[model samples]
Target: MTFKGVHRLLLLVFMGLALAGCQTEDTPAKPQFVSTTSDSRNSNYFIEFRSRYALSYGHTYVVFGRTDGSGQMINPEVAGLHPKSTSAVPYVIGHFVPVPAETGWSDGDLEEPYRSASWRVMLSQAEYNKVVRKIRDLQANSKFWQAALYNCNAFTGDVARSMGYSVPPIQLRPQEFVTKLREMNEGRRSVSPSRVLTAS
Candidate 1:
């Protein structure tokens, strides 16, 4: 082969190697969603639009209504309850809702008046992972709930925001946040709370 031809072949080989290196360097690994196997019943949960709500570790799993029409957090031991065919399925509400303090009210007064209502939502493993990741991210960054109140519901809203969902103000009343989540989940384009209120 001529010297010039040999030089051209070397250049081509060098270019190929550089291209291969660039491709390898630019490729990103597939993102792995959070683990679903950690909790067994996670898969059966259905994603649905309902009244807005939140989830947290403290209010891990709760039965929101009667067994005939209720939802519970996914757990390894108990199969989650859903709405009966004949009845409206009770929601699987998260623990993120804040519990109000009892202010000198009688037990009877507290029992009927202050009981918070909840709705349910079931999420697939991927969706659950997304929510979990968002929550962890917010917990790592914020102090709003650290000292004043440990509002899981607000934390859940923060997570929702991280997942690209429009959320109400981070400092909103629990009912308002719930209203916003419900609205957003139902394909509504509601205004997000001002970003100023969210934790940095």
Candidate 2:
């Protein structure tokens, strides 16, 4: 072959290799969970379980059947399921402030102070186990759950989508999902919000 033709061929080969490298770099990396020592983290493998659990309420229900029998003194359903046992009680206390004792109450009566906004039901041991198993399964296979996110619920939906399940129509679009998630994360939205507010 002519020298010029040989040079052109070499240049094309180099260009092809460069393009291939670019394509590889452009592809998204696999998702991973954040490391955490909290019991709540253990419950969901520390991968933004609160949002993931909330988003997958159906799964949550299946895992943690509606009952409180763990004797942990805090209910997962009302307090929010945590991977770590210690974290679970505190989480409930923080979110749902316990009602103070009556003015005449003695020191002994302090143990069972009422919760101002206690959850209606706590998850039984069987239910808690179910939740743990489901979370493990999601961690093992749910890609959306793995992705890093400023908003964890969005990540949960993304994982659901990755699993080939259609996300809720309300969460089909990213913007909508993010908006709803933000409200939930901020504690503005609830299962029963006093007033529904639309995103601007």
Candidate 3:
């Protein structure tokens, strides 16, 4: 053919490719907020954070479900420790509470003197495992818990990072840390605001 005939053929092909691209763009991607299950359907885990008022500086902790959806709470064990326990050679430990579902306390009823908020994590099963293992391993190490330094807030932050989540690096009080986490998770498919059960 001639030059004009060649030009017309090229234009038609370009228009066809553009239309195909537009069609592909019209299709929506699947939502990532839903929980991912393993081959045996064993992923009933949910990562959660709990924040409550404290006389000193407020408190924050991480909660998660067992493979069966049972609740477990982990926090630095410093409240009842004797002053001598944190003396010259300060020592701190962790408290792991595996709550029974039958108890109404699972919702975090702190009564008067305290208020709380929670957030549920929406991530894949594999990611959930990473988060859980991180917390559990830390819980097992008595050296990892420090009443002043590697406190519960730090613990939560570590777990969040292990799960591929991010929070501000600034030094934050417990409640502030919890608030920051919620803010960071806003609109993210990997996390969601959870029910807040307040007693006072």
The global C-alpha lDDT for each of the candidates, from Candidate 1 onward, is: 0.32, 0.27, 0.44
Candidate 1 local lDDT, 30-129, one digit each (tens): 1211111223233554322112122211111122111122443333111111111222121111112222221111222112232232223434556555
Report the candidate with higher lDDT, 1 versus 2: 1
| Tens-place lDDT digits, model 2, residues 1-200 | 99999988866664443233123111121121122121222232111222211111111111122222332422222112122222334323322222211111111111222111111112234434544555455444433211111112333444333322233322122223322333343323211224222221
Candidate 3 lDDT score relative to the true structure: 0.44
Estimate, for each residue in 72-143, the C-alpha lDDT of model 3 and write its tens digit: 333312111111232324321222111111101212323323545556553456666666666667555424
Q: In model 1, where is the ten-residue run with the lowest total lDDT?
A: 56-65
Candidate 3 lDDT at 51 equals 58
Models sorted by TM-score, best on top: 3, 1, 2
